[model samples]
Target chain A: MNTKELVEQIYKKKSFLCIGLDVDLNKVPKHLLKLDDPIFEFNKAIIDATQHLAVAYKPNIAFYEAYGIKGWKSLEKTITYLNTNYPEVFTIADAKRGDIGNTSTMYAKAFFEDLQFDSITVAPYMGKDSVEPFLSFEDKHTILLALTSNQGAFDFQTKKIEGKELYKNVIEISKSYHNAQNLMYVVGATKAEYLSEIRGIIPDSFLLVPGVGAQGGNLQEVCKYGINDQVGLLINSSRGIIYASDAEDYAQAAANKALELQKQMEEILLFKK
Target chain B: MNTKELVEQIYKKKSFLCIGLDVDLNKVPKHLLKLDDPIFEFNKAIIDATQHLAVAYKPNIAFYEAYGIKGWKSLEKTITYLNTNYPEVFTIADAKRGDIGNTSTMYAKAFFEDLQFDSITVAPYMGKDSVEPFLSFEDKHTILLALTSNQGAFDFQTKKIEGKELYKNVIEISKSYHNAQNLMYVVGATKAEYLSEIRGIIPDSFLLVPGVGAQGGNLQEVCKYGINDQVGLLINSSRGIIYASDAEDYAQAAANKALELQKQMEEILLFKK
Candidate 1:
């Protein structure tokens, strides 16, 4: 999925919220857990209840993968459900995978061709060779990890190199790679103040902003700095939305949380215009 | 697997070769394509033929993933075959997966717990949050991509910021992360000249060296500069070894290639001791 289409989807829906399905099997309700594929069942309920409130549905691949092939199958089922039921909602495989050239090709095939995720999150440490392989796939988005939300990001990402921060240099040098047109990035909501500087580097690319809600990053703070003319931010809420309730009304509670995010994003969209 | 155990296996077998299964289905023997799972069939045959000659097997995850669930299952089967038959041979899930703190936890589960891979390749873009998650897994090795064989590696990996190359900084910074003892690195054999410099930075960590065969990287030169007291190198040869022939004799041909590498490694061991 290209930046323009993602932007269009957000504008059309008047929402920039990307609902994150970072589900944990042990935490899932016992009723659903009884099923053959409890993870997929829970995801199906969440997707059904909250699809209208989301412009994108981001599934952190690790959660499903923890269940082994069962988890991978659930991931497959979840994507299949999204494709079949809510085709309009953009799908992000929150799979931060990066490797060598040949290996990246296979990852591209898994996410783009096999599993059919609209976008796959990538770690850009291996440089352009690891990244370009993902970018080479037509219209498939490769979301680079730029400035992450966690505290440890300050360790190396924000480290002062010559006169510049490594994170800043990463963003600048990444722009020079071929076919980087489909690239977006993860610039955390916690680090919202840097949006202006980050935007200057990659003005048009959408940013997958996490660290809102459960992470204590304010939506207003993120929207203030992150929202571009295209509403260029996918502010994600994973634990805050998916685990809003463990009761029978879990899906409904998820919808409520998702709706709150959608409402906030709608206001941000209004201000951006 | 732990470093000492891996070293002992290498010494006992008289080989330091980790045959890379960067297999593409289209590149495999045509006759095998008729099987229900050609990829697994090809891998099983190769493993059976060469397990005695090689102390380790590195299956690049991308190749299996390209085929989707089938590809992943093939990987599981390949690992299962190795574990059941040749329990001592180190198994590497050549999946270079690294992400933000929360997400990296999931990725660690995906490969280490779910798939039962002994080792996984990781990207170090988001610094500690991304890499620390993979390292947290007890006893499992996380091979971070340091220097690679491809042309595009020079794009960002070699970019100088503070008079130090990005790869150097990555290795130095990564060394400080918690539970870093299990960390190895992917240093391309083609860049053998930098092997000594890399060894200087990381004198202890095993270097998983690729680009050794068809990519024209010199094995002898890599050994000269990269080898440590422990023979701290897992020299990988993929296409040139496994696909040495396209006929039914493909597995035997792989064995021949592996034996050739084992013979060289044996000679190198003599020089070391």
Candidate 2:
């Protein structure tokens, strides 16, 4: 899906929420383990429960990869299900993958062509050549890691390079890449205060903001600075929503948690209008 | 495997030559495609042919991931083959993965525990928390990307951060991480000049050097500055070695190419002694 369709979905749903499918079997309900594919089942239930409240689903690839071939199978099933069931919801492969030019092209094909995710998160450490391969795919967005939500973001990202923060330099430099209109960014919600400066650099580009409830990032503060005319912010909540309750009503409980955040997003959108 | 074991293997083989198994189907022999698992069969042939000459094997994860589940199955079978047969050879998963603390742990588990690689390359843009999890794994090495072989390395890696280059800062900061002894660094052969300054920070840490032949890096030039008492470098050659020929004699051709590099590495080690 392109930026226009994503924005349309956000407006239609009254929520720019992106549910994170960072599924860990240890954290899921005990009953689900009896199923043939517990991970896919858990994700199917959660996606069904909260599809209305979310415009996107960002599946953390690490969670699936940890399970090996079985994990890859589950991931394939999950992506297939999403595309077949709810093609309108934007899908993000939270695979922070980047490499040398040719190698990166292989990765781009893996996520964008084979798995069929609308977008895949990419690490910017390897710089232009590492990232441009993903950008070459038309209509497929490459969400570059700008200022991450984690504590480690301060280690190198916030460090000054040529008298400016490295993340800002990343944002500024990435804009000049080939077919850069397909670029989006991963800006951590934990650093909401930095959104204004980030917005100054790429005001129109979409920012997939993770780290809300469980990570102590306030939704109001994130929306206060992050919202654009098109509402170019995907506030992601993983543990806070999906792991709300591990009982049989776990899906409903997840929906309830999502409802709370969606209501806040709805109010914010209404107020902005 | 521990650092001691890796160094021992390097000396025993008299070659720190790391064969890169970046098997692209397009480049492989036409006959291999007729096999049920061409990728695995290709890797098995290359490993069997070149196992005596090379001390390490680095499988580029992107190549495997590109094929989806079948690719992952090939990867699993290839790794299993290596571990079961050539148990003495060191393995490196050229995944270049990193994320937040918890997510990084999952990735570490995927590569180190599930995949059972002796070492895995990780990007350092996320800094301490992203990398320390990989370090925590006993005997498993975390090769952090310092100066990559690609042209994009000049984009941000060479930029001055706090008066020192970003790669140097990465080396310096990473040393303070927990279980820093398990940390190795990825210093591309293209930037052999940067190896001296990098050696100044972590002399004992192994450097996984790619870009030897196909990318125009010299073994002797790299050895001059990068070599330590243990001959701390794993010189990787992917296309130059593995894709040497695409005929029925592909395995023998690959072995011949690997033998040339192994001979060069032997000369470097002798000269150093």
Candidate 3:
């Protein structure tokens, strides 16, 4: 989906929330396990319950990959269902993939062409050529890692490079690449204060902010500093929303959690207006 | 495979040549396309032909992942073939993967538990927690990206951080993580001059050196500076060796290319001995 369409969806839904499908068998409802494809079934139920509450869905690729071929099949099914049923919602493959040019092209093909995700997370460690392949795809987004939520983010990302944080340099340098317009960024909500500094670098680019609920990032603080004219922020919530309950009303409980976020987002959008 | 087994294999084969199974349908022989699983058929043929010449095989995961489910199935089959037939040859999943702690654990399970590769490449962008889970696995090696061969390596890796190169800091810092003994590094062959400086930091850890023939890296130069007491270098050749020919005798031609590398490796090991 184009930036305009994504913005329109945010306005239409009153939320820029992106639900994370980081499914783990141990975390899902016990009753779902009896189903033939529990992962897909769990995702299907969650989507059914909360598709309207969010404008995007980011499926962490590792969750599916851990299950092997069976996991891959479930991923394929989940994506197909999303595309078929709710084509308006933007889909992001939280895969964190990047490599040398030719190898990266294959990855672009894997996520963009084959699995058909609207966007994929890319690690900027490999630099220009590693990231440009994904950017080259028409209408597809490449969410580059800026400042992640993990404690590990401080280890290298925030380190001073040329007297500025490496991530700041990443945001600055990446802008001059082949198709910089297609780029979005992964800026963790835990570092909500940094978002103001980050916005100064790439004011227009959408930032996929994870770490809102389970990771203890304040949504109000994130929106206070992260909001743009086009609602250029995709706040993601995973475990706190999806694993809200393990009973038969698991999907309903997920919707309730999603509704809470969506309601907060609605107020944030109202304040912006 | 343990460190001792890997070192023994390098000595036994007299070659640390790592053949890259980066299969592309367009590059393989036309006849192979007739098979039910062309990628697997090609990999099988190449493995059958060159199992004796090379001490290791590094299958670039992107090539297989590009084809979607079929690609993953081919990857499963290729790794299965390698483990079943040539159990002695060390396998590296050239999947440069790393994520949050829990997500990273899932990736470890994907490549190490399900895929069963001896080692897997990891990007250091996420730092310690992202890397430790992979290293936690017994006997499994994590080949961290330090100084990549691509032009992009100069983009951030060579930049100054605390008066030292970022990649240098990566090497120095990674050593302090848990199971640092299980860590290896990916140092591009293109920067052979930097290998001397890298060796000064961690002399014992293995270095998986790519960019040999097609990327124009010289094998002799990489060995001159990068080699350790354990013959701690796995020189990878992908396009130059795997896609040696596009005709009916493609596998045979690939073997011939691999033989040339194995011969060069043997000479390097002989001098070391």
Clash pairs of candidate 3?
Answer: none
Q: What is the TM-score of chain A in candidate 2?
A: 0.99
What is the TM-score of candidate 1? Answer: 0.96
Model 3, residue A148: C-alpha shift (Å)? 0.3
- How large is the interface RMSD of each prediction? 2.2, 0.6, 0.6
Q: Flag the better candidate by DockQ, 1 or 2.
A: 2
How well does model 3 score by local distance difference test? 0.94
What ranges in model 3 sit over 4 Å off?
A: none
Candidate 1 structure quality by residue, lDDT tens digits, A42-147: 9999999988788899998877767767777888999999988888889998888887677788788899988989999987776778788888888788888888
TM-score of chain B of each: 0.98, 0.99, 0.99
The pairs that clash in candidate 2 are none
DockQ, candidate 2, comes to 0.91
- What's the DockQ for every one of the candidates? 0.62, 0.91, 0.87
lDDT of 2 by residue, B6-54 (tens): 8898888889999999999999999999999999999999999999999
Candidate 3: tens digits of C-alpha lDDT, residues B143-227: 9999999999888999999899999999999999999999999999999999999999999999999999999899999999999
Q: Provide the overall lDDT of each model, using Cα atoms, as 2-decimal numbers.
A: 0.85, 0.94, 0.94
Candidate 1 per-residue lDDT, tens place, B39-88, comes to: 88999999989988887899887787677677768878888888888888
**Greater-lDDT candidate between 1 and 3:** 3
